[model samples]
Structures are given as structure tokens and as C-alpha cells.
Target: MLYYKQLKVLFLLIILKSCFFAICVAKIGFSTKTPYEFIHPPQKNVIEDDWYNAHTDQYTCGAVHVSAVIRHGARNPGESDSKRIANIHMRIKDNIKDGDKFKLLKDWTNQFPVNNNKNLNDAGENEQHHLGQRTARRLKSLFLEEDMSAVQFMVSSAKRTEDSALAFYEGINEEIPSEAPEEFDSEVNDENLRFHTMCQKYINSVENNSTALKEYKVFGSSDLINQVLEKVIAKLGVEKNVLEPADLKTMFVICGSEMAVFKFSPWCDLFDDEDNEIMQYWSDLKKYYKNGPAYRITWEQSCPLVAELFTIMDDVIAVIERTEEDKDTEGYLLGNMMFGHAETLGPLYAALGLFNDTVPLTSKNYHEQKNRLFRTSEILPFSANIMFVLYECEENEELLNDEEEEDDNPDDDYRIQLFVNEQPMLIPGCKNLLCPYTDVREWYSDISDDCHFEYLCDPHKKMHNEL
Candidate 1:
């Protein structure tokens, strides 16, 4: 009787473990999908006073500066993807199995029109608008002035990014309802935001190199992925070899894109949890080699952007450390916001060593790296951003509880917090959300001092600070 009772308990535990694991891994992972599903907007916190999520222990005297790098909102699939969608649509008629779920796909015409690929759909626009509103609400101190001198903004040349910036601007005024600037900086070019495109080494080593995407390509051709593709074709009743890996990828892409625009998509039903994980790894591998830590040139090319961010921080620190009599505020700006693409944030994250996996990603380690930290669905989704908030952490009795007071240092007057997708990113050296500025600067200094755009991009060129 005791043995039977133990066995029953073990079986129930096993069932519960399986159910929990299923819920954790592989739920709709894609860049086009809104991150709000995975990371909820900080609506409740925005209404509160503290900069953090109601953790009032932070002794933030005032915010000195803020810098953010935001990716454009959800965009339509590219031209090639639209063609793939049409191709799959053409094949579906003779192949699709009849069911209530099949009703949508069978009667569906492709919503994507020619030349509509790069533009922001209505969903994309709304994402950025809310982001802007939230940002403004969270940092009200920066927008209180009528002069509008406190804030600066820039964007990539891409029309989607420009439109995103405009939407963000509109959202900001909705929150502050003040005399905000009518225009963002129109002169900041691709060299500042899309530096990878201009970088010769990045181009030669990753972007244009046929062998650069070897890992991603190899993974796509693996038995695991092939089996998934075979099942997809079988389910659709399409002929064998009719759908290539790229076409299957296009199916996933269309599913994510349509799901972002509309609340639901029939294309999404073609993929199961396992298929979702497989597709995620496939896309992540491409980003890893092309712009992540897999290739040195991938992150190394982001030198200029990193350098620019650190230099601004240095100026703010100088102001913070100055004595009351000798104080000066010549170069300090309250905020800077720049809008770019997925290419912009991926390389920057790598340069900062934010989400590096323990081992380099490979086809053999696909399953092993299932819990890897470099997943982009959470980091690079539509309207995703990486922001640095510098605060003057004046020593206050309120900041230190009885246990913390003994070790507190008055000299630690300034602190910094890095936010990713509107949450404080857990940096290795920092203890919590707000960390010592000096310790954070130590991690930042080497990258900032070493980057010379002309020198790193092309060895033959002389080094100069064009940034």
C-alpha cells in the first residue's frame, strides 16, 4: 500500500513538470510580434512617483540625463516575404484539410500588397505611441519646461523609423501636453544609427560573406528542422520538395506579422510549440552570426554608437561631481532619443556583452541552448528600446534601512540604471536596478576609449573621432 501511494505521487509530479515546461518554452517568438505580450507596459508604475517600479528606497535626487536606442515598431513583411505568402496561398487550395480553423486560410487572400513591405501598419504605430506616452509619464521632470531645450531626438533615414519617431513625438505631447519641439534632428545620418552598413569590416566579414551565415544555414538544413518542414508540407497536402526552408520561414514570418496586425492569424496554427522553438532558433542563429557575439566584427562595428553614449555619460558625471561654487552645465542635455532597426540594437547589445550565451550557438547545441539568454523575441521586438537613466543618488537617511546604513558611502553620489524594453536590465556587476556609477563606468570605459570608427572599419585608415 505504501509503495503504490509513492508511485502515484511520482506520476502526478511528472505530469505537473511536463505541463509547466510546456507553458514556459515556445509561445509565439518573433521580432514582428509586440513585446507587450511577453513584457507588459509599466502602466501602474508610470502613475507612481519613484523612477523604479515603486521601489522608493532608491535615493534618486534628480535625473541628470537619459539616452535611449529604440527599434522601429512592427513592420510589414518584406517584398520577398510577400511573394512567399502569395506562393503558399496558391498551393493551399488543392492541399488544405477541411476544418473550422481551415476556413480562414481557404477563403483568405493575402493582405500584403506590393510595395507595402517596409511601412508601419496601424499596430506598429500604436506601439510606439504608447511607448512615448509611458516614457513621458515616467520622466516628467525632463519635459516640464516650455523651452523644449532639455530633449533631443534623431532617427535613421528609413521611412518606418521616421514615422515611428513622429508617432512617439505625438505620444509625448499627449502626456505632457506642453510646447514640445516640432521636429527631431533630421541631419543625423546612417553613420550614427546604421553604422554597420557603412563599416567595411562588418560588410566583408558578416553581411556580404556567403560563409558568414554558415551556422544558421546549417541549422536550417538539420534533420530536426527538416522533419518539422516535412510535417508542415504533409499537413498542407503540398507536394514533397514544394516548400523550401525559406518558404517555411516565410510562413512563420507571415504568421507573426499578421498576428501583430490582426489579433489572430490562421498561419499561426500551422506551427506547434516545437515548431515555434525551431523557428526561433533558426532566426536567432542568423542574428547571432550577422550582428551578435558570434562574429567579432558584428559587435566591434558598433564602436561609434557605444563611444557616443559613454562620452555623453562622462559629461553628465563631470557635472554631478563638481562643487557647488565651480558648477557648470555647458554640454549636458536632459535626454536623447534615437530610432533605428533590429540591426542597430543586436550589435549594440553584443558590444556591451549584455546577453552572451555560455557557448557559441551551433546546430548541434540547438536543444542544449534552449534556455540561452540571447533570445531576441524579448529584446528586439517591435518598439523595443535600450535606455540609460542617470540619476543623482544623494545620500539620504531614507535610502538606507537600518541594515544598509553601516556600509553606506556618502561619496557614492551618482548612480546609473540601464533599461531594456522598459525594464531595468540586470547587469552582472551591478547589485540591482540602480548601481554605482563608477563600477558601471569601469565596464564602459574600455569600449568607449578603444572605438575609432575609421580605424576599426578599415585598418588602413587613420583614426579620427568623426562621432
Candidate 2:
């Protein structure tokens, strides 16, 4: 009878323990109904260039030459974005209640810093430093062999970009000081690096052209933006009638920037998956209309830089061809690396016909948007880059022409491979990432024809100039 009594007590204790656990969960509000209880970190899809290992076989033809155009690292919110976030915080503090969710929001709001300047924070600097280190490790051979003069490192005059370039250079030199340059080169709004900024016509067209920005308006007004905004505003405990889209957009930008700077911010958790999709689409609209395919001059504005890229590649090839003949020929131009803004990188990608969606992105296709290829976060994220690799290889004999020809020699072929954010980009006519240098050159040659600076930027020219 004593043993039976002890067993009953044990069972009773278990039941009480389960009840207590249920109570804690209920109080914690850890359920879908309480979606905003914890803020999610900003989407990392557009944050930075993720570091990756290059396959050993990737350099088989040898990374004899390489070039890159990259965006700056993570940064603090810009002037406009900063003001919006601050204003929203003030509003929240004034109106917040003493509820469970409100307390969490209040805690995060307290932690969020008030500084609203556009500069590289600690995390941003680290991103650039790590990019340099990764580049050094990947091309250790090239770094060891080439000096600063042989390798080109160029940056825009912006403070963050310059800092990022220096950080990258520091990473390379730290690993192998022998080939590192004592100082990196920076240019102030160089036409090649920042052509759009310098071109008044392009800027005016983007800002004032209603026809060009029709799609931006469509996307911004779609159910996507409205529903998401309504949901986000409610979650933030703000009235939609009280807050406007511009005000809300500032909050959105701040949320992403805060997540990047602080590693995690309550602002990030304001949006769920569907909300994030809407936000992403909204961002894509701005990027597209501002620097992408929204305007006619978008691709043409990037032509000057494309020309520069071609020149860099041709110069490197000239050296390679000479080295092949005389082996002792000075390889003065082995690699070229550039750091620029999204203003430069976005249109440049569009000019190159990369990341283009087969079906034009539109509000009517919101349901099919998921299948579209032109995602801004994927293509124009911080520290994003596109690399062109020039290589020489012994051609495959069996895969070669059956008819003997003097230039058909398998051993004399040169190859090129292109990578965007460390992933291979497939050219329309090229075989995989690796394609014949001649074919790649021809493709770029065609691009260069359409991207003439004088034709696109010259207001005096009889082209698409309304101003």
C-alpha cells in the first residue's frame, strides 16, 4: 500500500510539470498568432558576397588573368533612410502600450542606435577585409608572382568604397606582402566608374520620365506593396492612416541596414516570409527603374565602363599572347580589379545581359514573380562582383575539327570564364562557364557597339534626349 501511494504521487508530479510547461509557452506567446514576438534578421540574400572555396580543377587552365567589378561593403543608413527610422522610433515610443509584444518592440527600440550616417561600420570593414583575404587565397599564385604595377586595384572616391578597397588590399598584403601594392588607386567620380552620376542627361531622364517609371509605380501600388505595408504597419503598432509609404519605406531600409550593422535588430522581425517577398519586389522596382532597365539609357550609360572592361581584357590578352611567343615578355597587365557603387554595377550587369528575366517583371505577374530571374538582392547586394577570367588551355583533340587547319591546333586555344558573385555565369553561346576567348571577345564587342558614351550621354546628339 505504501508503494502504491508513492506511484500515485509520481504520476501527479508529472501531470503538474506538463501543465507548468504549457503555461510558460502560453505566456511566452511562441506561436504563429504572435508573429512579431521576435524580430527576424534581415534577408542575407542581398547583404554581401558570400565567401566560397574554389574547386581545385577550376584553375586547371590557370587563372592567368582576372578582373572584377564590385560594390562597397555593408554601410550605415543613408541620410534619408536615417531620418525615417528615427522618426518611426519616436512615434513608436510615444504610442506603445505595456503589452507583451510591445515590451519586446520597446526593448529592441531601446537597443537600436540613433546614428544616421552613410559610412562603413565595423561589420562592413570586416566584409571587405575578408573579401581581400579570400581573393588572396584563391589566386595566391598570381599574387606571389605579380607586383602592384602588374595588378590593377581601382576604387571610386567615395569614403566607404575607398575604405573597402584598402581593406581588401590589406587582406591580400597580409597574406603575401611580396606582390601587394603599397597603396591602392582611387578616382573621384571617374567617368568609367561612375558614368551615370556624371551624366546629367541620364539622371534627368530617370528622375523626370513618367513613361520610364510606369513599372515602378505599378509595382509600388500593387496588392503586393499595399498588403505588406498594411501588415507591417499593424505589426509595428502604427496606424496606416498616420504613416505614409515614404515613411514606411524609410523604416524598411533602416530595418535592413540595422540588421547588417547590429547583426540582429528587432526591425528585421517586423516582416514575415510573404511580407519579405513584397519588400523584395518593392526594392527590385526601385533598383530597376533607377539603375536598371527602366530607362532607355540604362544599358547605354554603362557602355563606357564596358569599354574600359574590354580594354583591360584586351591589354591582358596582348600581354598573354606576347608571353606565349617570347615567354620573357613582361606581363604588365595580368589582372584588373575594380570597386564601385551599385549605380555602376547594376546597369553594367544589365548591359552585359545578365540576370535578366525572360518574362518582363510586372505587377500582373506577381504570382509568377517567384520564377523570374532578375532579383536585385541576388545580383546587386553589398560587395557584389562580376569576374572575368582569361585562361589558356590545350584544346581537346577529339572534340576538334576533323579537317586539318593551321589555326585549328588544339594546343593554341585560349579560354575565358565569367563569374558573378563567385558563381559561373553562362553565356548565351558559350559552352558552360568556359568559352573560346574569340567568342567571348565577339560577344563583348557587340555589347561595346551599343554602349557608346558619346551617343548615350551627349545631350547634343539626336537620340533619346528630352532635356
Candidate 3:
């Protein structure tokens, strides 16, 4: 009878434990907590160029130019986001009547000032500096010198972007000191980097339109909100409550922000993986409608940058063909570094035909689209970069006698490799990992022939809201 009584008590304890909501990991998506470790490329390392020689022994190659477009590193939440987060946290603290296990939340104080949000935090600076150090080491061949003269660096006018570029440049400076004759401008307002803000159609039709975000809003207000609410109540052990879906979003945002800065947070303990996914979907849907493939003009504005890329590539051919005297020409260039925002990457991805979902992401199909490609965390995470490494190659025999033979082929093949967040990514029309320059050019020819930004962003063009 004593054993039976003990067994019943044990079963009762097990039932109570099952009823408790266990905490899971916190995943903040593209907002912060970049997939790239900020200290390491979370993917396998592909930094060295030596392995390619084994695959393509017929041709000897070296990287002559590298063009990288990168997003800024982790930053503080925006002023509005910051304010909302503080407000929500305060309300939760106030409503804790009894049985609440929110010791950390109760003790946690909002030290981050409301008005000073969205600037680069110390952690953000560290991320950029580390990335720059890695970049200098990765492109050691191109970064062989302490000169920035051969480099072209550009950034959007945002203080955060400029801060990130400076941080990256400082990282490069550590490896190879900067002694360039001239410094690149911080305020070029280059449409290539700041295309979204410059385009009238994108600004008017998408950025300003609340109705365009209807699908995302529907998802935000869907059953997931209740799911998140239930989780928060169970985990917080709250007896009294005053929370809404918007407050939950603010909660998630703070969870991400705190993680980015402090590397951990108690707020994350309130969520399960599925709860986090719902929050991520809410943000992804917004990107899809506003900057992604939803509208035609949005991605087409990338024509300017595309035209510039191919032109620079064509200049590569001209570079090899020209005499040594032309090396000192006024406009001779070797590399370009542009730092922009998530707004920048989304449209560019759309232009390149990357990360497309077969069917649009909506409130109803969240579970079905679990494996969809438009995940911003994977593609547009903080400090994410798209690397365009341009290689000049020649037949092994031709390379052996290049200085002696003036009759070398001017039509020498140039190879191109694309890397996303430092992992090898193939250009859409390329045959393999390393693609011929001409072939890649042919694939994006529409950049020159079809897309003209002025025409694409016609202010008077009627906007379509349907996916």
C-alpha cells in the first residue's frame, strides 16, 4: 500500500511537470543574432584559393578584383521599437500578481535609452571589426598592400552604414595599414547602394502603403498571437495579465536586441521554437510585400547596380588587354565595397532571382511553407555580405611565359565566384562553382537592355497590390 501511494504521488508529479510550459531557445531571425557567427562564418570555411588549382589545373588564376555588398552589423532597436519594448516589459512586470517565476524579468532594467536606439552598439562594432579582419585575411592576395588607392568604398548615407564601413576599414587597417592618397566619399548617395530610398515607386507605393502590409498584418493578428500569449503566461507564471499581439512583437524584438548585446536573455525563455517561427514569419511577410517580389518595380531598380557590375567586368577585359602605360589612367579601379541595409539586399536578391517562394507566404499556409527560401535570417542577417570575386586566369603554359611573350591572348578567360556570407554560392546561370565571366554577363544582360531605373520607378505607374 505504501509503494502504491508513492507511485501515485510520482505520477501526479509527472502530470504537473507535463502541464508546465518548458522554455526553448530564442531565435530572433534577421533583426539581430546574425546567422554568420559575427566571429566566424557559420558555414564551412572557403577562405583559401589553393583548392581550385587541383580542380582546374589547366588554368592558373589569381583574384584581381573583389566587389562586396554587405549589410551593417548588429545595432540597437529603433527608437519606436525601443520605446515599445520598455513599455511592454514594464506592463508585464506590473501585472505579476503571484506564482510568477519572472525573477530575472523583474530585476532586469531597461538601461538602453529610448531616443538613442538604432545606432551601432559596442557589440555591433565588434562584429564589423571582426568581419573586416577576416575579410583582410580572406582576400590577402588583393589586400597584399597597405594602399586603399586601388579600392573603391561606398556606403549609404545612414550613420549606421557609414559606421559599419569605417569599422570594416579599421579591421583591414589592422592587417594592412591604410596609406592611400585619397579617401572615398561618405555621402555619394549612390543609387546603387541606396536604391530603395531613391526610387519613387518603392517609396510611395510600398514604403508608405499600410494596405500593402495586409497579409503580414493578418498573420500578426492570427492564432499565433494567442499561441505566443499562452506561452508567455505559462512561462512567466503570471496570475494577472495585460498583453496583446503587438506587445508580444515588442517582447520578441527586445529578446533579439538583448541577445545581440548581452548574448543571452530571460525574455527568450518565454518562447518555444514554434512561437519564434511565428514571430519570424510576421517579419518575413513584411519583407515579401514591401521589398521582395511582390511588386515589379521594387527589384527592377537594381538595374543601376547590375549595369555597373557588368561594366566593371567588361573593364576587366579592357584591363588585361591594355598596355602597361594604361595602368596609371585616371579611372583605373580594382575593388569596390558597398555597405547598405536589409532594404538594399532584398531588392538585389529579387533582381538576381534568388530566394523565391513558389507560392507567396500568407497567414494560412505558415506550416506548409516551413522550408520556403525567402528566409531573411539566412539571407539578410546583420552584416551579411554577397561577395563577387573576379579572377584573371590563363592557360598554365601561357602563364609560364607571360612576360616573355607579347603575343599572349587578349581574349584570356576570366573566372568569377560568388559567395554569400563567405560560403560559395553559384551565379544563377553559371555551369558550376567557378563560372566564366562572359557567361555570367550573358545571364544578366537584361540589366543593361531591359531595366532602366527611371523607367522602372515611374512615379505615375499604377501600383499592383496582389502577390
Candidate 4:
């Protein structure tokens, strides 16, 4: 009787422990739905009569060149099966009994590698197609169908980038030519063509005199540098005899490398000082490249591009300046604008001067913009309109007309204006939090009267709404 009682007590204890464990797990995993919860709500409409009226005069003002640095459509960050394999491996390592068996399982799992595949998964493919269609439609509305063919194309070599570009061309029924012309060759190889070009330009700027190297202390010795220069020239495919100037206008360059390389590049190094700077940059870059660090290389590399993109505004201003000065050049230029991305658009936004300001958006906000931009898992998705304007500044005149003004008194500045999705918005004040979704949310809430949410709750009302 004593033995039986002891056995019953043990069984009861085990049962109670199991029940407690189950409860704990349930608590950890379970979540309650709130009344105001929304999965992915519809974004607010940005186009209004005010926005249309502002640009109405420019419709027939001739050709304009638009260069968009777009984030690629929706995609699984890494290989699709990575998570499943990781979960299984983690479980086996944690729960398996034998040390040898665990080692064997780990090796087997690790042996199956993950990489970007050209033939994207179902979600990626869909994103590509949808984005392509949307891009085509937008182009049709913005420019004559015939004009799209003339616009130069440059896309990153990543599978998604190519996929996005292809889908875009297909949607417009633009012929996918076998190859772009040699003059427009923007494909960057591993040999560092851009760096080499910059080096050559730097050398030429100094009149090829080695003594001039004293000015830029960062550059190494110039005596043997000529030999290095020869190698750089050969590697970059630059003919030493050719005297043509570097073509910086009307050319598109698409650079794609593992995020790791971008972090370690000289450009990133410039931002950080010596001592721990190089190591810190490498560590940060590697973290993003190895693990999923959300938007990494795209943002870091975009800073310089943003600085350069400002030149566009400067060009627009120059046209305005020319108008002010009564110069002979055409006052305006217009063309179809297209950009491709593989993931988050945070980098694109960062490169566009938005990230440099105070109070930038966060990664969470960026993710929200992703859902809003794609609206589906389809590849090659199109984002809302991004409008840039250059207004002529009088010697002492206010930058904006009273109705088109922005808060923070942006109108009082030099008058370079940027609009996302046709809304006059402020750039986030900080680099760390420049997430686009937060901006979208704020914009949506601000203009809620103009945007109806009936489509979010009712399946029947969820029809495609386009700009």
C-alpha cells in the first residue's frame, strides 16, 4: 500500500508540472485581438487638387529626367527554407540525447546553404509581376508609350533587381533587348571601376604631377603609384589615350555587392574616425550581411548618392537660375523615372537627404511603408508618386506660395522642395529612425478625411485603387 501511494504521488507531481509548463508556453505564445487592431490598413491618398494644380503647368513644359532609387519589391530576406532548417537544427541541438548525433545533424543542416536564386519563390515572382505592371501603367500615364524606350536603364545585378527591371519592361510591353548599348554600360564588376575612375580623375585633376600629391595626405606615395594607376586603368577598361571627359549626365549606374563590402568601403570609413572606426564599420557591416539587419548597406551607401542627387535639385535650380539670368538653355527637362530595389526602401530614403535630418523614422516605420508600397506579395511593385520641384527663388522672396507651404517654415529656406506621394512632408530629423511607414501613417491620419477605410474591413470593397 505504501509503494502504490508513492507511485501515485509521483505521477500526480509529473502531471502538475506538465500542466504548468503548458500554461507557461501558452502565455508566451498567445495574443489577444483588440477592437481597433488592423493587419495592414490602407494608406491615405496623397494626391489632391492642390497637388495636381501645383504641377499642372509643368505637364507641357518639355522633357524631365527622373532618377528614382527604389527599394526592391517584397521578398523573403534570405533563402525561404533558412528559417525551417534553423529551427530544426536549434531544436535538435537543444533536445537530442547523443553528442555525436547532434554534431552530425548540425553538419548536415549547415551543409545545405542559402542564396539568392534568379527564379524567385512564388511571393517574389508575384511581387515582380505586380510591380512591373504598376510601373508600366504609371509610365503610360506619365509619358507617351514611345518615350519609355529612350530612357536609359541601369539595374543592380541581384536576382530581384533584374527580375524587377524585367517585369517593369514587360508591363510596358517594351522590348527586352538582348543587351544595353556599350556607351550605357553601367554594370560594375568586382575590380572596383568606380574607385579606379575616381582615382584617375583625382590624378588628372592634379595635372599628373606626382608632387601635387602633397595636397591630399591620405593618398599614398606617387612615385610607384603610376604603376598602380596603369593596373587600375587596365582593370577599369579606361584607355589612357582617350580624352573624353567623364560622362556624369544622363547616365544610370547600378552597383550591387554583398552588404559587407559596402560597409567596409572608404566612403563609410570617412564617417568614422580612426582607432575603432574600421573595426566598428566592419562589425556593423558584417552583422547586417550575415544576419538579417534589416536595411544595412543600402542606407550606408545611399548617403553619398543623396548628396549627389542634390545636384539634380541644383540642376533644376540652375535652370531656374538660368531663367533668372535669361540664359539660352531650355528652362525644364522631363523624362520617365524608374528605380529598382531588393528589399526595404529605407536606404533609398536615406540617400535622398531624408535620413540626414533630425528625428528620422525607425525600421518599424520602414516596414510599414513596405506593406503600403507593395499592397501584395507581387514582385516589381510600384510605390506612390515622389515629386520633386525646383522653384525660382527671388532675391528675397519666400520659397513657397502660401497654400503650398510646409510646417517648420520650409518656405523660408532656399526653396528646394521634396514631396513623397504628392504630399508636402518633412524629412525625419534623425538618421537612425527615417522609416517611411511612419511618415505614411502620419500622412494618412492627417488626411483621413480624404481617405476612406471601407476597403480594409469589407472584402467586397477591396478593389485596386491607383494614383
Give Cα-based local distance difference scores for all models: 0.73, 0.63, 0.71, 0.31
Worst lDDT run of 10 residues, candidate 3, spans 46-55
Model 1: residue 30 alpha-carbon error in angstroms: 1.9
Q: Model 2 over residues 1-467: C-alpha lDDT tens digits? A: 23323444553453365357445221111111111102222232422212222222222356567788877777776666665666777777666553467564564443333454467666667767766666666667665756766667777767877887778778777766863255666555467677877776676677556766677678777776777778767876666565655654666676666545443445656766556666667667667767776555776787777877777777776777677689888665666778887888888888777776767666567678775566766676667778887676654445446684335543235677787776678876776677777777787786664566665676665435221
**Residue pairs in candidate 1 whose N, alpha carbon or C atoms collide under 3 angstroms:** none
lDDT of 3 by residue, 33-109 (tens): 44346224332353544322312545666777778788888887788987787787777777775534667677677
Best by lDDT: 1
Question: Roughly what TM-score does model 3 have, to 2 decimal places?
Answer: 0.84
lDDT string for model 4 (317-387, tens) is 45654675686766443322334442223334433434232322232232233222222111112232343
Error of 2 at 252 (Å): 1.5
lDDT of candidate 1 over 1-467, digit per residue (tens): 23323444553453355457546534457643534444554364566324522223656456677888888887888888888788877777666655455676776666766587589877789888888888877877656563345566778878888888878877888877854345544436687689887998778767888888888889989997898888887777667756777777888888777766664566766777788888888888888778788877677777778887877777777765564446554546777788888899998998887888878888789879988887877777888899988777655566567786533554476677788988778666777877777788788777778877777888454423111
From the highest lDDT down, the ranking of the candidates is 1, 3, 2, 4
Instruction: For model 4, give the RMSD to the true fold.
Output: 22.4
The best candidate by TM-score is 1
In candidate 1, where is summed lDDT lowest over 10 consecutive residues? 47-56
Model 1, stretches more than 4 Å misplaced? 1-25, 31-38, 41-45, 52-60, 94-101, 179-186, 319-323, 326-331, 397-411, 459-467
TM-score of each: 0.85, 0.80, 0.84, 0.36
